[model samples]
Target: MKTIFTAIFIILLLSACTKTLDIKLRSTEPKIVIQGNVTNSGGPYYIRINKTVDFDANNEYPPVVNATVSVLDSNTRRVDYYKYTGVNGYYISNNLFGQVGHTYKLTVTVDGETYTASSTMPNFVGINQLDFVQTKILNKTRILPQVTFTDPAYEKNYYVFSLAVNNVTYKAFYAVDDRLTDGNEMVQQLYMDSSYIQKRDFVTVILSSVDKNVYNYFNVLQANSGASPTTPSNPPSNISNGAYGYFGAEAVSMVSQSF
Candidate 1:
């Protein structure tokens, strides 16, 4: 009877220790996150990787590590691969970022797990007509440029417009307010009223490059909010880098007009 009792006690003690060990192992595993956006519409693009916070807790952005990006064009069958740059968990590539009609895909490996995503290049809506004129707001001089373009209207589409002035060395400032279409309020205001102003001597406007996913997000928002950009419930933080930066995407837009 004594031997049996001792054996039972040993088994119970081992079971309790095993549970504790499992909890400790879970705590030590790394918490990581990864996100990316096209910084420029030009050939060279950057994939930004970052880590998310612990379960609903606020945490600083953590850059991703050891991630690789491979791009293949559907029509060209051309392949390009990018290696992670040590700066801010970014992968840099000059030749593989995007092309007018090509499809792009991304795959990531982290923590012994693999994640995959793909996006097709949004149609490049060249600006057939662009101009900037003077206007006044609040009795103060505010430079505004009015842009017009025909929507290609794909099955699912998203668009971003970028402006560059002077040359590649210098940048110009302006805002789209929202997407453009026929006879919308913002578009109407841009044309009928003297609301448009010129901020610079000339500026080049190009359509923004986005995948079908982001396009669907904005398209739905536009249908609900009209052409006006909605008021932000939670404004962005001091961090000024991501997709929301001043000139978030590339400016390789070839369309240009002189004031």
Candidate 2:
């Protein structure tokens, strides 16, 4: 069943590890960062707007208020206007429910400049089960979460998995595709740094069926994960017109298990 993961915030926190750049950033015009999502769970979808801080500045993200934002549902040909709550850069949608196989378009105007993006909600794929395995590396034991699901052979699918340990979130984004094992029952393990998962910790995994741009976004981050922090390189955002962030649609499934 579809349950238990928050939107906008997850996308913000999913890229949490990218903030650890070692070199101090030069002062420049702060770009508009938009974290928007349309989900199948229905009503009151939220989007967050914020500005980035300097590399060595405090970790707080300042909200960008009074922006005009709207989302268009292609299937219904209707638009939902979002009004800012004037806190946390959040905007609330009025009367938009996510549907599988429908495309969504997001438009945001800040300071007379507008940015646009599009994403489609794919069919839902639930988790068959969750399992755990232990592996030794460099003389240390690591706990890995195994996620099992059957991929549909008729079409291509891309997914992103979010992990949390004892209610504490992990710092990286995990993404996978069904290129090699399409139509088969696939068991995928999430591998992190040594000893990250400990015994008796309650682990939560959220599997998201996302569009290609969203998959490519996280895939780029996963690939450049080992780059030097001083010269960090992130993939260009899916949003257009010079904004930095993503507007996505997610069909999700989640499960929690004890480690």
Candidate 3:
């Protein structure tokens, strides 16, 4: 009788353990990984998706095939969708052309998981004017370039600035000091200051991009959103007759001094 009771207890314990393991396995959800790359040519862009990684696994990323891909332009006019190539997780747009003045919107869907990202085409903010000025920094030289903009502003302001050594554009670095100053008040000066001596002949100050809405925000507060007092292209260009223009397309020019 004692041996039979012991055997029965062991069997019950094992069955309970199995039930607990099944419950734990059913509670977990799958993860996803997203990867992206852009090209320098006029058009053609691609994106890939895969299963998310786990810390315990050696190769966490698993290719996600048959996912959907879509791209939207700045004007919200041009939108392109890519078809999956059927090789375990790849998508491509053959006719998509990325323009400097345009912005892009991307969406990816796989295994009931969806992800989205949007970015504006970093326009080459043409250097309207630049000149070197004497500075107190002993080891460094200062190149003061006056930047002007011909584009209009938008809402939800933001900006990203970059600097590059002219010939080798590959190693472009963010203009640490690059920025936009308050358009409202007249500023004493706006230019970048750095430890690196910018060779006027070899270096170029670049304003990669700026938020149109933020640009207009600065102007609206300062009461300069007009072409009369300033030039026709001055502040408030992002506004169309008092309402926010283009739903998402806003442009701003960063003056060198503002940086």
| RMSD values, in order shown | 19.1, 5.1, 21.1
Q: After superposition, how far is residue 195 of candidate 1 from its true place, in Å?
A: 15
**Model 2 misplaced stretches (Cα beyond 4 Å):** 1-27, 54-59
How far residue 238's Cα lies from its native spot in candidate 1, in Å, is 25
lDDT of 3 by residue, 1-259 (tens): 5664344333222211000000001112345444343322333344555553333344445567778777777574777887765543446566766555676666666656556655565443343554445554556545443334333233222332333333222121222112343222111222343433344444434343444443343334233322243222322323222221111222223223222
TM-score of 3: 0.38
Ranking by lDDT: 2, 1, 3
Name the lDDT value of residue 249 in candidate 2.
88
Ranking by TM-score: 2, 1, 3
Q: Assess candidate 2 and give its TM-score to the true structure.
A: 0.84
Global lDDT of each candidate? 0.42, 0.76, 0.39
* lDDT at position 176, candidate 2: 91
TM-score against native, each model = 0.53, 0.84, 0.38
lDDT of 1 by residue, 48-161 (tens): 556544333433455677666555555677766767756655565557544555555555556565555555555554555565655667696656556655545433334544
